[model samples]
Target: MPERTETSPAHHGHQRSPGREQLETATTVFALLADPTRLHLLWLLAGGEADVTELASESEAARPAVSQHLAKLRLAGLVQARKDGRRMVYSLRDGHLRRLVTEALSHADHQVTGAPWHA
Candidate 1:
């Protein structure tokens, strides 16, 4: 068996199995993502970092709702926020999450629009 490196993919290329903690954490992430409003917020952040105003405006969801959603996502470590003067700027925590949100929405688009799935 090849030695696992920091960048190695889990499972298929090795024998490393997901532990209970990993499984539980992933389930929690999915649970957080189950809400359509939250999913939309994540999808927006995937584009680029933005403040609450921009997110609320673009999402067409109320500003308070956007703030609450961002708070939940931030607590989950899915998204991060930084103070930009008086406004709070928010963005995905890492490339993995960015790709996850993008791919999930893309899959939904395919399902809704009857687009053919790619391999």
Candidate 2:
């Protein structure tokens, strides 16, 4: 076998932690947002905090499904939930996440057509 070198491409200027872990975190976040239901939920939550029933009604998804998606989003740190009496209200955890989602969607729309967002 060839002798391992500290300057090999695999280790060249790489941090102790693998880049793949960061990529995986990003991929997980994107994957959670990829679902149409989840995207709608995020859009609604972007306005303010809402419970599962409200999210389901706004997104046209079943209550249980919306709850499940919210759970995943919470796990990813993209959203937060608080207990209000008998219901759990969810909201965006980071304001930057909201901006990122909006910018990405706008970019995707622009890519599909030549028109850009005026507002």
Candidate 3:
């Protein structure tokens, strides 16, 4: 394990607590990400904004499904959409989430390739 630095809390932050509501909200978000389609949608949005047609084509999911997934993500405050004429352009709402999706995918790649995990 990596050594804890001055910035690091000696123990898990959870030990100090973020309050039940905050933790529950986080778990709910994680539950949303547990869905493969939803996770894919997030990963795609992290790259940049795209419309439903583009996201459907790139994700290889049905257009309706992509829209539905986007709706769920949007409601969760994970993504944002803006009207671009008749099209709705979507993107990840923050850089932290972008990095989270990227790191998760990288970890997934390591698992699939039997690569050793690194900290």
Error of 1 at 5 (Å): 18
Segments in model 1 whose C-alpha atoms lie over 4 Å from true places: 1-15
lDDT of 1 by residue, 68-115 (tens): 999999999999999989989999998877777888888999999999
lDDT of each residue in 1-119, candidate 3, tens digit only: 56766557445333454679987987988898999988998998888999999999999999999999999999999999999999999999988678778988999999999999887
lDDT of 2 by residue, 2-90 (tens): 55578553453444554888789878888888888888788888788999998999888998999889988998899998999999989
Give the range where candidate 1 is weakest over 10 consecutive residues by summed lDDT.
6-15
Question: What's the lDDT for candidate 3?
Answer: 0.87
In order, what lDDT does every prediction score?
0.89, 0.82, 0.87
Write down the TM-score for model 3.
0.85
**Model 1 lDDT vs. the true structure?**
0.89
Q: TM-score for model 1?
A: 0.86
Candidate 3: Cα lDDT at 74: 94
TM-score of each: 0.86, 0.72, 0.85
Which candidate number maximizes lDDT?
Answer: 1
lDDT of 3 at 37: 88
The RMSD of every model to the true structure, in order and in angstroms, is 4.2, 8.1, 3.8
Clashing pairs in 1: none
Model 2 scores what on Cα lDDT? 0.82
